[model samples]
Target: MIAASDADKWKKALLEWDVTSLEEHPSSDGVCVCGQTGLLWMYTITNDANGAELFPIGSSCVNHFGRTDLNRRVDVFHKLALVQATANAGKPVEMTTEFFSRAALKFLFEEGAFTPDSYNYGDGVNDYEFLLKMFGKRDKSTITSRQGYKIRKLVTSKIIPFVLADPRVR
Candidate 1:
């Protein structure tokens, strides 16, 4: 596990520079734990040779990550997974950390889960009330309301059907 101090330092360094030098090979192709294809960008900590470490930064990194097209392909995979999961569950499943972190934003966007206006949610009151209502209706045995909202929005949206109808999720 990366220490908090180290993580913070890395974050600071990343913010200061638009790009970092490749200490070694810049990228590697692999499958994420969620089964999605991922490009792991490697970086080395020059400050501490004693504590030298290698880490896989996510695709969001400007450099060393996969091409934009590959990221989009991976996003499609994530959306398909969500659709399959929802269909198999026979009900809308809540979004878990596993879903968001592993899933692609494009899929969420296509599913109407990510709308510019929807994200606004007005102000504190509307957002809080919506959250409260969702919480009240949540299935205690499953995931939390926060997770449910994300999953449900995506499932209900027409985007999944429009985008993936060829595969026939049902």
Candidate 2:
């Protein structure tokens, strides 16, 4: 077990960056190689001592050992995992955390879910009541209300999968 006070020693021993984040693996059973044991994706901590000693650490240990930035990335990956799981299940994911992350918002734009008035529009792209922050709004003015409804249904069911790997409907 590494004590927090020894964190600096660990940092000083690193031949490379003090920390490196590994993407979460699909198997939750993988053990964290830090002195602590349990399932969490592994992080590689490499040190030059004795010709480069490397070991894996859990996401929690990243912060506990003073690698807060890596911890944030771990959180982002956790959300991504949730989104992917929902997508694989063929369920419709909303724009909430379970559906997507802020980092992933650009996917909708790239997919042409809705074109913003400008690049800097941010979350103001479309604010439909139930679908606030959703990728697009059903434009009734351009299409009749009935057509808009049908399009929404089709987009929610079909276009969404192509727009994002994550489910895009309730």
Models 1 onward score TM values of 0.29, 0.44
For residues 49-162, could you state the per-residue lDDT of candidate 1 as single tens digits? 224433433334433333454354444444455555565566554433333333344333444533344554633333333433444543646656575665466445533444
* Candidate maximizing lDDT: 2
The superposed Cα distance between candidate 2 and the true structure at residue 5, in angstroms, equals: 18
Best by TM-score: 2
Model 1 residue 155 distance off true place after TM-score fit, in angstroms: 3.5
Given candidate 1, what's the lDDT at residue 83? 52
Pairs in steric clash, model 2: 93-167
Give model 2's clash tally.
1
| Residue pairs clashing, model 1 | 95-147
- Misplaced by over 4 Å in model 2 are 1-27, 43-56, 103-170
